[model samples]
Target: MTPGALLDLTDATPDPARMRHERHARLVASMREDGVDALLLLGQANAGYATGVRVPACEQARALHRRPVALVTADGADPHLWTWYPDGAPAGLRADHVHPGLRLEFDADARALVSAVHDVCPTGAVAVDEWTMPLRAAFDHPVGDAGPTIGRAKLQKTADELACMRRAQRINEAAVADVKAMLAPGVRGTDLTARLLERAFALGATGNTVDPIWQVMPSSIASGPHTLTGDVIFPLCTTTEPFARGDVIWVDNGLQFAGYQSDFGHTWIVGGAPDATKRAQCARYRAVVDAVVDAMRPGVTARDLTRVARAVEDGRRTPWLAHFYLGHGAGTESAEAPLVGTDLGDAFDETVVLLPGMVLVLEPVIWDDGHSGFRAEDVVAVTETGAERLSSLDFSDYESTR
Candidate 1:
């Protein structure tokens, strides 16, 4: 049995200072174009992208009050970060630019934040990603939504950003190795999450973005959780339900390294090898991913990817979850722009033109109803010629000897 290797994987490294510098430059350039004098980033991913702060794994509510914030100016100076994670701050960030976490729940804190923004821009416009009532009430000047400008800046990744993603995938795949080694008929779904997280943190994963999904799918959609669309349910919460012989487990997980996220998904058969029909599903899924990856190049539209994937499906329901998407961008956020085949529809897809340096995570599901199915994510970095595979898991590449 063989495992897929990280494409050009690197060993351990220090903070990615150059990546942070380049990202800050992009943010500044975007802010200047948008006429945004200052950026007040409260969203976790946005803040991380602006400042390169590696926030720890925490529940969302807990992360909110304690989350790091970044304030970027059009001057192209270092982005100021207010955070509880002083160590996670990028090495090149100015010492004066770092500060303690702001507790915006307090009125004074909200006013202080407004003051901070005013300090930088004074009369110029400030852009904000999120806002609290307190923050909104305290503002003395007009502001724009930071999402548009920030999204534009982050659409294309830099060389160092690709390196960080590669490092992240390497760590995530290593953890999956341990989890796969322990799979057996008696193992429970939550049990797999335990091993995955344990191994990930041990291998240097900085955070777990979402609870691992180890849903044991049924033979058909009816036998699974009831859905409005009768489509096969995926990603049901992980539970202690122990596995039996030939249980089909759909594993999906996300974790972080230096603020960049890693996405992983694969179908694992318990106790026995995949039957012939199951292998067919795997083959179809692979074909869809291959077609999409082959078509990944600069100027390609997201519609082209969905079209190729649908051609492989041959009129079957879209190869991805109806509720989710065929592919999404992976970077500071687990899922971002350029999503393919989502509810946004064909018009939206046409507008999303692929650019070099955009990372795409394509997860195609091949569910052969009565026989069960296969789903897995393939992460690729769009390049000038085509795309580079970032993830290491291939459903055909057995992770362990059974």
Candidate 2:
């Protein structure tokens, strides 16, 4: 068999500090426009985006390729990083390269973080990404009320972010092919999961989720919480119900290498031909994904794309399309904003158009609740004319090798 090569794939490149500076300036303008005094990036993703630091350990898991947080003021002053990680951490190195003027401090101590923010920008209504409490609360203060600032900024993706996302997509595609090649007719999900992990490590991923992609949600089988336990895997192929003549194998896996993630899923048939009903259902789901891609032009909203996906799924009585949202934004984190869900309104919000440089993972699945399911996911970049598929595989012909 051919060995995996240490190939250097080109990634989205941006002047990290310059990007932060521009964002700060935009925030300043936004503050003036919205009448907000300052903004505090409480969520790790937002904070890292602003200041170039990885703060929360949990969020750091996804920070395999990027910084953790950036806190800026309405005036668009130099952002500060809140974290205990020394300057030696990867995030710190990234910050150093891009944001030489950024401030760095630890939030747990309270004195430094709170004092620094107060010293820099004391007055005005503070805005924060309240949804990201896991990384927030580290630097609590008696300042102005924190509003929704980071969420607004995060909803939109810059050119640099899209580039990084494209690289992640390439890495994920390679890892998936490598891992799937190791599977046999009756390979246990646990074993297959480990093989995928091995491939990810070989490809230079900083960190990975303990749970295999096949066992995760929207893929079907509900395995036990913990990762490995004597190989009684629940999702993909099981020891009890190993790959049968016509079993469908869906791999909903992810890879986070160098602080970026590529989350996508694909389906395969066991040894023999796939079931007719399932194949048709997969076809419908694939068409739905295509519809979303076709409608993903600039000036389109999550609502508009979601409508297309929902319409296709509703057209068929398939469970996959109806149960889950079409797709979501991908970057330093696996799941981000601008999601296509039922919560969307009448039309795609022109306010949040599908602009160039935004990287997205389109995952439209059909879940069997307990018995079976099928999914085909791919990472794509929003170009000027339309979206570009980043995966090496032809999503139109996604199939299982085993």
Candidate 3:
């Protein structure tokens, strides 16, 4: 790891309350730029980002039973949070903005919610994080998708948000280290997954602050040829297949703290030592990762990084080793915007300019038809001058004892 990377990980923490206020301010500015009058935040992440209050996991069960929502005006007014029960409001919420009456009756119609919205913001077109048929019917005014607007606002992270994410990454590293320490021949993928979950909680992986939502995403663990074939999809299913002596172990996992997420992966060989061939493959993958990270900086476009990755791959004798795009932005959601790739296809919008305060993961996947696959990921934050690595865990190959 670079000295700059070490400094980035050890930066001073910021006050959470202050951070929330700054984030809200940015959202308000974004709303103004988009000409939105008010925002009706429906997505859980969107609500949490706008207001410091996060809907607890317990209340999530009532999602269908009732609606817990937030309303923030573009004019920089204090946001309003509506929940079914008064107790559902987070302690951090301001007393004035907490409105418990927005809850609907068991058989109540959408008119009740519509009336509540009108009461909050008397008139004007509203932007909704997610639009539902009922919400559309309730509002007589025009409603537009607030996803893009909110997403753009979230692209830049405040100091406090970065601090929480850094902490999450530290906890994630410790948990994954624990699991790596237990890897050996004959160990099953299920065994590693179990240990990962156990260590995650032991190391203060308290899910997200929104409610102790533990490991909502399952660990992705694969061994032997399964690693190379990419047959084991994410959120790996429980499997009893034993790891072999020379098998590669790929563990792609995630953990969250205070609603922020830490997502990364590392590769290891089951035996204590890797042969020359495996060592070379690991070095090749590391070079790809380093190239991508070096290319990440403010003012660089996603296409620019893609071009650099292509150059690196073209220089390699075996260009077919790379199988996926270089990486994507990481934040509130594991995979966010500003994806870096040559052809992201229809799934991702390929055009985006990298900016300071943006966090992204550089994951270059390498695979072969019958051999094993290898990949290492590192999280980086675009800095004013360049890029700083947020994830401190080493991506180099590790050899587990037998």
Candidate 4:
């Protein structure tokens, strides 16, 4: 066993096991409403959210992260966590205290899974994350459509869930600071990213849902978003071409602390005077983001907010340059419902309204060949009056790194 290093930050204790039971009850209630007898969660994030178990199967040792599935057959009955490896541990020591009703059991085939469900649910509607079940395994029984129900539940985060997300944001801010300090000319991209990863663990991050992605594009490389290797790297832009005076460096990364993920992007210039166009561009993006953040309140529609952001962006010289919405909600997933975009339909229902406990990501960016990309992402909580920013880091100045 590789001895784990002691961390300065206290390990996040798992929520009361009862929380899982409560969530299970809620899931089962929803499942029953849909006439489903059992709900099978195959996705790791969903499984972990449902049972607090966070281990991957041996087959998932590659780039893919594996999460064991948990089958909840009844509204209040014990749920079975099926996995080849049952005793694996999670960051919050969730495995140590399984709910009195939730337990892990080994399964070699679909027959065992069917047998287990039959023992409890007997006969009724069955549901599963269709994407996860194999064709052969799915043939064992008929399942109902659970996509909408599960997605809606996942999209609307509870107060306790928002608290966990804030913890993630805190860790993410520190990791970003560490990445910035590691930036310098001549530093290898891999080395820079490695340091950021070290800092993440050192600062008490319980490994991220995804690896910290940092890609340092050399100025020699065209200044384009695609230049990123689709992952985080250090010295954000190549130090080989070391950020020169007046050169713009783009940084895009998602800081995952705890189980939540925060996506943010900003562009910085090595040494340059404020150019009128650059200053205006930065201000435009910031204003749109600010408006969206301020616009969040109970009873407001996500689409309306996106429209507001787009209108603000369109006022600028490059109207359509800023295409997407100002931001989205971040919890177990990076991009979930209540999105500030028009493309999303009832998934971001305005009637749902903002609850005081709801947490969301406020990020808006503008990118054009003539100008660079600039955006700020922060976690915020909805209050009675409006929305309150949760991130403590300074994001006021986005044009320069100093």
Using all chains and alpha carbons, the TM-scores for the candidates as numbered come to: 0.95, 0.73, 0.81, 0.76
Model 4 agreement with the true structure over 1-402: per-residue lDDT tens digits: 011323223322336455455556667667766777777776666666666564532344431223466676656566666543455433333353232222222334455556666766777777777443342363465666667656656655555565556556556666666666655544444564577668766766655554433343333325334533431222333333344455555555555544556555555544444366566667776787677777877667766676677677775433222234456676666766555553344366455466555667766555544455444565676776788776654544445543
lDDT of each: 0.86, 0.57, 0.67, 0.56
In what order do the candidates fall by lDDT, top score first? 1, 3, 2, 4
Q: Which one wins on TM-score?
A: 1
Given candidate 2, what's the lDDT at residue 193?
A: 67
Give model 1's TM-score versus the native structure: 0.95
Which one wins on lDDT?
1
TM-score of 3: 0.81
Taking the tens digit of each residue's C-alpha lDDT, what string does model 2 give over 3-108? 3644445654545656555555555666676666656554555555565553333444344323334456666555565454555233323353233222323334
Question: Clash number for every model?
Answer: 0, 17, 1, 8
Deviating ranges (above 4 Å) for candidate 3: 1-12, 55-68, 83-92, 100-109, 208-240, 315-324, 342-350, 395-402
Candidate 2 global TM-score: 0.73
Q: List, residue by residue over 93-184, the lDDT tens digit for candidate 1.
A: 88998999898877898999898888888888888999877888898667889999999999999988887788788888888877888899
Model 2 CA lDDT for position 244: 44
Candidate 4's C-alpha runs over 4 A off are 1-19, 56-66, 84-108, 131-138, 215-247, 255-258, 270-277, 317-325, 342-356, 383-385, 396-402
